[model samples]
Target: MSETHTSPVVLDVWCELQCPDCHQALEDIRALRARYGDRLEIRLRHFPLEKHKHSYAAAQAAEEAAEQGKGWGYAEAVLARTADLASHGEKVLLEVARELGLDAEEIDTALIDGRHTLTVDADHAEGKAIGVTGTPTYVIGDERLDGGQGQEGLRERVEEIADRLLAQG
Candidate 1:
């Protein structure tokens, strides 16, 4: 009998770049990536809250980073300094781009031109439609886990769902 291969489970993580809570949730994201590797498809969906002044721009910068093939790297760098981001705003975004060897000018242009606004807006809208009201929200299958409530047991719950999906596959 021939064996069939099913697509990996998609895990959409709703996040706000300027949010400290979302920064903290990076640990769990890394752990999940390490645990599942290719078995789980983890997607970072932007949900820039109005409270964070620079979050919307940061989301657009993240899209520019993706265009440069340094999406996760740029995000991790920016998320590592949420305080700086809050204080310095767009400057911090450009700094991270330069630090990562990405085209800072291009990122700046992308930001000013609002080229990635539609993408960011779309993600935000989808997040809202799915009831994602906070950063670090995890959506696996039909489950929506809000890490804003608490990070405790979130990773375990994600693992359970991922394992079940992989098993079914």
Candidate 2:
């Protein structure tokens, strides 16, 4: 993979902020990145479920945080505290953004104004177009690994694919 392609292998991760499965998958992805370094490129794509009332808002908050270079941190905070998102969703998101040194009021206003709705909607549409059925779906090479929640098999599976991609170079 190193010599085959000049770019890093893409790990298209379609996830939602309020999904527990997505949170677990994010942890797994962090571990993978730590182990592999820059050899892999993980792209976070929003796929908020319609069932989760605050999920779409959370996605916008994440993007708003991204503008301040805290996208991943905000996402981690939201995913970790998904329970509180029901009643105090926006408040919690702003708190998380502030905790990450981002401007809470800016993010809150973005959420109120729906600044990142198009980005989130486009990702959702793309995910649906590609037959995504749930959160934590991984699109790597020709393989699509879905339903990675609570499964011990994901790590080895991802390792196998990542190694093969790297070997191809």
Predicted structure with the largest TM-score when compared to the true one: 1
TM-score of each: 0.98, 0.92
Candidate 2: residue 84 lDDT (0-100): 85
* Residues 36-105, model 2: lDDT tens digits: 8788888888999988889999999999888888777788888888888877766888888877888999
Prediction-by-prediction clash tally: 0, 5
- Specify the poorest-scoring 10-residue window by lDDT in model 2: 1-10
lDDT tens digits, residues 1-169, model 1? Answer: 9889889899999998998998899899999999999889999899999999999999999999999999988998999999999998999999999999999999999999999999999999999998999988999999999998889999999999999999988
Candidate 2 to truth, TM: 0.92
How much is the lDDT of residue 39 in candidate 1?
87
Model 2 misplacement above 4 A: 1-5, 148-150
RMSD in angstroms between candidate 1 and the native structure over all alpha carbons: 0.8
Flag clash pairs in model 2.
Answer: 1-166, 1-167, 1-168, 1-169, 4-169
